[model samples]
Target: MTAKKEVVMGASTENPAEIQDGGAMELVRVPAWEVKYKLDRNPDELAHFVCCRDLDWRRAVCGYEEPEAVILENPTTFCTMCVEVVQAHGGVPGSGRCPFDDQPCPDDETVDRMIDERTSRP
Candidate 1:
């Protein structure tokens, strides 16, 4: 009998606290903040600000040399930098207590829906 490789789901190696949205993990597009930057002259740079860069510790995990360089958005994982900033500021990082009071970090369904909406747009 051949043994199957058991794949562990939920939370990425890069971030243990990250939330997993199961299958939605397959379709994560750019960060939700991209909705704002889609029309900006400096979209890349401005998008980074949405994840927050004021905290010094964020620079290490963020891995972006310039705000304009970050583009990948993992649906299963909240931005580590964003998480740290939220926790540091006494707010939570997930759907319950997202840093942006107006825009809470959405759940898996919301993330996937946003991606679909963006793609379906004319």
Candidate 2:
């Protein structure tokens, strides 16, 4: 099989999970810090900053909103749903466990790989 040609694409902080590929759409790894920082501030502000500043989305791919979550046996990814859960639970301090899992959240590398593989399809 021929290797898929990887293309560089930009994504907004408001919705990083969705990526534009070949006029179609695919999900990809959007660094954790981008999501976390966006979660910390107003979504509109974050989106504006991302557009104006062209923030680096690959630098901190392992950031977490909750200080404790990062130290858990398995760290969880900071995604759109994760942000919603955190907000519903009253932010990081109020969120004690992973919303999706009973144990803990998945790690950064694990989440990144998952996204990469899913989006690398031909």
Whole-model Cα lDDT per candidate?
0.33, 0.28
lDDT of 2 at 105: 38
lDDT of 1 at 102: 39
Per-prediction RMSD in angstroms?
Answer: 17.8, 14.9
What's the TM for model 1? 0.32
lDDT of 2 by residue, 25-84 (tens): 224544433332211222222111000111223211112222211111112323454345
How does each model score on TM-score?
0.32, 0.26
Model 1 per-residue lDDT tens digits across residues 1-70: 0001111112233533332533333235334333321222332322221332121111322333333322
Q: How many residue pairs clash in each candidate?
A: 0, 1
Q: How far off is residue 12 in model 2, in Å?
A: 32
Query: Which candidate number would show the highest lDDT if scored against the true structure?
Result: 1
Give the local distance difference test score of model 2: 0.28
